[model samples]
Target: MFVSVGVRFEANVEALNMVETAGNYSKHRRVPYIIEEKNVLKIIYVPAVSGESLAHAFQELLAEEAISEKQKVCRKCLRGEFLKSMDEENAAEKFDGGKLPSDAEKLEEGIVKNCTVEDIGGFLYAGKPPVKRTSAFQVSYALPIKKIAIYSTVEPQLHARHAVMTEAGKKTGGEREGAAEQMIYYVETGTAIYGFTFNLDLRAIGLSAITGKPIIPEDELRARRRAAVKSLARMLSSTQFGAKLSRFLPLGGIVSLAVSVTEKPFTLTSPIYEGFEDMTLKRLEKIAKEFNEQYQYYVLGRNGLETPEHVMTQLIQYLKERNTL
Candidate 1:
């Protein structure tokens, strides 16, 4: 089974993913988006979040969920450092000082067996005859919805830090020895309706990418798949997978969401475009008829639509009925 999700959300005064800082001014990540206006093409820079950021958050949540279910997770991944088997030394850490298999296939099997996060998230070992496992899941950068992207804005908000004056500073004419009594900074906050896509290949979990075989037992495979789905549902419902949430949590929930499940791989129309929900429904119908494959879809913006949790719950039920979960 393959699952694809497209999301459109509103974020207000959010600094969820900042890229750089220059002289007390931090900047939000931005990317160029092209659009056509009056028979002319134009490019606009808009605030965005990197796919790396989204992937990291997903893996972190996966680790947490896996551990809670008594599934194996590597030490580094458990601590949220996803330096997945970068080299021999790093791969060995998952084995607790045991010798790592020299054969690439054996190494991949061992790592998949030992770490649910690595199995789902993939890894590349830059060792002799390097081995690579592609991630079963894919995420796209969070970009502003194209229709209203021109109105999206990133503005600097001023903040200040004040320190108590010391007696020595008072004696030195209100000047601290090596520090200022007060400091001012600016945080670039963004407001927009952002869209992103996430896809998970359920067939890839607990399967050996190197040898085209199963690496773990069926029970564990089901557990890992469930963990992956639950992690995504939780992340979207809570909107808790970005930076600076303590102070700059976005003041919005999901504006719309669409999810598709297929027997074969299929991607939904991107939610950044207008009328994506209808487009996705039509495309799914065409693919089902053309390919003669079973598929299911749910959209949250439609009439009488349920919450994200409910939508995911329905998906889990569907997968369970098909014995895919």
Candidate 2:
């Protein structure tokens, strides 16, 4: 249940005892942010009464804040003072917790890992991929496009903007659709990297297919999911996928990698959306289904994921697949 404490910014949950967690933006940190403008800031503060109406409220506030030309101290200076005030005040008073909880303790869902091998030629010899963080962990991956797309509203990761409420945000962030899609890293030897972007409009996205509701409270969700899915996909494909199916390449071409949530309520619920359900199950199921199918082909499609379970099952199948392989 969502505790009505206040609006949460970059917090997420982790997993243990082999439970299935979904929908949290575990990888938003690694998402590259290109600073389009120097010292950029966002409009996030909203009144508690607005509740679910926060997005609209935020929109109005952002416009006013952007135009207000009153000579005021820069945001950085204000943040510094805020920190100083917190120091003078008891830690417990500044934050309910004496100190913020470490990210590991907060992330209650998803597997985090990195590529064991990525900088093949630079880091290692040809074909020898570098060892990265963990599979479930979010890492930087990219895809290059000759052009870009449009979004009615965009939450750009540029200049450190990490999310958006719509698919256009995905396009602006240059993220793929689906958590199963891997984040393709396009090494632009020709041009400056990070300039390439993906613009997705979540408003145009069809979350209804998974959730019964048509509204998504966390607008930046789709883009975060897109980046995370692909990152995990790559980790799964090269690592877990390799370990699991060494002996049988796409066994019977019917290999299916899926998640059997040993957890509660959402293990069965779909991503059809609940504005309240932060972890949507249907979305997880769909991601897993796609991952399983793609494993058969042994390709990640530049940067793509076949399913959320692709990495989930891949992690498990690796142990089983290796024994027989």
Backbone clashes for every candidate come to 0, 74
Worst 10 residues of 1 by lDDT: 172-181
Residues 8-68, candidate 1, lDDT per residue (tens digit)?
A: 8999999989999998999999999987788899999999998999999999999998987
After superposition on all CA atoms, what RMSD does each candidate show versus the true structure?
1.5, 26.0
- Report the Cα lDDT for residue 223, model 1: 92
Any runs in candidate 2 off by more than 4 Å, and if so which?
A: 1-219, 240-256, 260-325
Q: Compare the candidates by TM-score and give the number of the best one.
A: 1
**Can you write out model 2's per-residue Cα lDDT over 104-158, one digit (the tens) per residue?**
2111110011010110000111111211111111111121111211110112121
Worst 10 residues of 2 by lDDT: 113-122
Which pairs of residues clash in candidate 1, taking residues 3 or more apart in a chain or in different chains?
Answer: none
After superposition, which runs of candidate 1 have C-alpha atoms over 4 Å from their true positions? Answer: 176-179
Residue 44, model 2: Cα distance from true site in angstroms:
54
